[model samples]
Every structure is written in C-alpha cells, then in structure tokens.
Target: MVVKNLIQHLAQLAALEISDSEVPKYQAQLTDIFEHMDQIKQLDLAAIAETFRTTEEENVLRDDIVTPSLSQAEALQNASLTHDGFFVVPSVMKDKDAT
Candidate 1:
C-alpha cells in the first residue's frame, strides 16, 4: 500500500545525515496515518447520515441544591486583625504622622 511505502521511505530516512538518536518513527507513523485517513476521506457518503457517526453518550448530572458561601464575617474570621466585621491591616499609604 502507499502508506506502507511511505512508512518504509521514512524509516529509511534514519540513514540520512543527522544524529544516531534521530529517528523518523513518528513522521513515518504520521505518513502512514494520514494515508489511512485519506482512505476514509475517499468514501462516497452522499446518503449516509452523519449523526450516526457520532459516539456521544448521554450525560448524568447531580440534582441542583441550594448552597451557602461564607458570610463576610466568616470569610475574615481567620484574619490576624479584625475590626467591626472586617479585616484590618497596616495602612499601605504613609500616615501623615510618619511623614
């Protein structure tokens, strides 16, 4: 087959100037694969239903349920400093007293 011939041609490419570790195995496989794919492309499918070619299966999902996130207070509960239900940190801008 043309694919096999292409694979053989690619395998022979290892003898070309390069490195000993270099091999065209993937290139050869790609050549063969594309040739095989060309066979599929050659099909006369004017009457075949394309949807039947799909392999999709039905999906199963869990039931939706109400969920709650941490409230502002709970979210900052582990903060090192808390003030009036909010996290407090040193002022990023220089305080006027420090200036």
Candidate 2:
C-alpha cells in the first residue's frame, strides 16, 4: 500500500489525529521499521535454535511454601468496609446497574 493510504488507514484504526504535515515523517519511520523487519525475516535461521529470550538468565523465583495462617476476622481487621461474611467494595463498573 502507498504510505499515504497506509498511514491514513492505520491512523483511523488507532484512533489517532495525525496532521498532514506529520504523515510524511510517520511514513518514513514506519517504512524504515518495516524494512528492518523484512531484513530480519529474510535471514536463514535453519541451523539456529529457537529462542524466547536473548539473555542467558534463569528463573530466580523463591521456593513456594505453605506456611500462612490468618483467620477471616483477622484478615478484615483493617478493612474499612465489610458485609455479612465478605468484604464490601464499591462497584468498579461505570454504572452500578450495568451488566
């Protein structure tokens, strides 16, 4: 696709407000990026192993052990709101009646 049309389509899909003066600049940038991606895709990697990460780091998570003990009343001691047997929280939806 022509850069102008591609930029217009992308701007519409992304809900972006790009001025006409900025189209050429964005077009150049996107063109360069796609060119680099194309170069990378053209590389022959048949002999290379698939890699998910570039670094040689290993997982560093601590061992998980079951050693926690807290009653429901104790857990809700500092809460500002509570119902019968659960915490009462304000509705996160935009409207309380929305479903």
lDDT of 1: 0.66
- How high is each candidate's TM-score? 0.37, 0.53
Q: Count the backbone clashes (under 3 Å) in each candidate.
A: 0, 0
lDDT digits (tens) for residues 1-99 of candidate 1: 334454456555643333334335555668678898999999999997768535566545677887988889779979999988888998776544463
Give stretches of model 2 more than 4 Å off: 53-59, 62-99
User: What digit string (tens of lDDT, one per residue) describes model 2 on residues 1-99?
Assistant: 237989989997876878999999989899889988999999999999999988888786778878879989998898899988689999774643457
Full-model lDDT for every candidate: 0.66, 0.85
Go through the candidates in order and give the C-alpha RMSD of each one to the true structure: 15.8, 5.7
Best by lDDT: 2
